[model samples]
Target chain A: MSSPDSSLAEQAKAGDLEAMNQLVAEHHAAITRLLWRFARSHADLEDLVQETFLRMVRGLPAWRPQQPFAHWLQRIATNTGRDYFRRNRIRDRWQAPLPSADDAATATQPEAVEPGGDPAARAAAEEVKHLLARLAPDDAALLTLHHLEGWSLVDIAAQYGWTVTATKLRAWRARRQLRALYLSVTPS
Target chain B: MNTPPDPGDSRWDDLLARARKDQPAPLDLAALQRSVSLEARRLASARRAEAPDWTALLPFRSLVSSCLAGTCAFTLIASWQVWQWWQVMPWAQWVVASSGGAP
Candidate 1:
């Protein structure tokens, strides 16, 4: 849905302070939601959202507002989230839990599911996100935009800088590969 | 309740929908706006400062400028020499004509 922030967008484009403030205020939640899905970890959420806004302001001069302002801003958020992970991948791995000696000795054992409400649902969600993280960055972004964000093919195409047909074709390929990837990862 | 949604199928849409929860959000962006905008402006200025100078686009820019300065200096010197010759030419001709006629 197109956000009703066009007037603010127009004024922000001109560097109007009040309009920019209102515009950022208006779009923040949508930015958070977009980045939340796009982020590989919850820890990166705040930084990613902040970077998105910074990029939006940096890009304001070039934003013509022919399309919805939310679309433009969300595109920046998506890119920022992806870029944050890409840049931090090595650091993230470095920070990952080192396998303890006891854990290493029991490697062949079936892992104990963490105690939580509805282990099945939690496991499924965790698996989904894990599999999502394994997908090629573009494929993950495509799925998140199309499926998670419910963005239209046209919106996806515009925001991702692809033609409609290209977006469709790429999404098709991504989904197929993701299905295989999912099946391979999750227990039957 | 069943096997997880089939990827590449409509079932996956349900999984995606559940992931969002799609709550309507009215966020407070004032503090964030101020901070991010200030940082953005700072970065923009820094980027502008780090940006290449217009002259840097040309290889040997300083050499070209120096050549241009030398060309201007030569032109001015040549013009002055021509003006001096022009002024002295008629006088020399008149003196020759007068001296020849007197002799």
Candidate 2:
């Protein structure tokens, strides 16, 4: 919950390499994880992180201390992730073939090892991830920030500059959709 | 009797634990630090070498920005003026008569 300091921002703005390194270390994992989940590919993680940090470095000179640096950093990170998907959308579409039952099983189901995997659980995870991929980036982001990161609704609302009610509503709808996807993928 | 935590209930935690167990040995922090320092020095040198001659373009960039701003301001003001005139277009002759024929 504690955010980075203005002194750190100022140092990075002045091109302090140590400060830049510290900033990256502080937030890069969260950003990378978020992007990776959305991307469904680890290959995009490094590029997205680099782009986000580069933008942060460039925009540092104009940054004001009035806002939480995390929020601003997250905005940049999210936009960079979204831009990555947008640019490679077509290629990614061609590359990521439809999820097989096995692929779905591997990606979802909480990494439980059984004789093979509990087909039902794998089906559940795949259905969820597939449905999640179809969601708007904002919706996907909110869901991940809440469920995966275990962040409070208020924290997510503040981070994204959304009203608490709106965030909750979107999250609720997203969960419902994910459940529906899981059910649909289950062999009745 | 202390009950064991259900493995099924904590799959994510279990997976994370396995992942940590599978990771390679700890990185050499000192070596990493040295490499980072070296990269930093190289980046700094590169930046200095690629420094632009901003002094030469400062005047031109400033002038262009100022002129564009002024033109935009003028256009806005002119549009507002025309709009106001169109809204209350009293005849010029009638205005003169109302002012007692300019005495």
Model 1 clashing residue pairs (backbone): none
**Candidate 1: stretches off by over 4 Å:** A1-6, A65-67, A88-126, B1-5, B8-14, B22-31, B40-80, B83-103
What are the per-residue Cα lDDT tens digits for candidate 2 across B18-90?
3222211122334433454465566667777664555555677788999999999999999998867754666
Task: In candidate 2, list every pair of residues with a backbone clash.
Answer: none
Q: Tell me the lDDT of model 1 at B21.
A: 56
lDDT for each residue of candidate 1 in A7-92, tens digit (9 for 90 to 100): 78777777676777777777787777777666544345566777788888888878875777776777788778667656655554
Candidate 2 local Cα displacement, residue A164, angstroms: 3.1
Q: After superposition, how far is residue A188 of candidate 2 from its true place, in Å?
A: 5.5
Across A10-119, the per-residue lDDT of candidate 2 in tens digits comes to 77767787886777667666665555444433334545656666677767767877767777887787677556545555565788755654455445543333222234
Best by TM-score: 1
Point out where model 2 deviates above 4 Å. A1-4, A33-36, A82-128, B1-103
Candidate 1 residue-wise lDDT, B1-103, digit = tens? 1323347455555555555553222333666788767865676677777646644665587788989999999999999888677656757677668879521
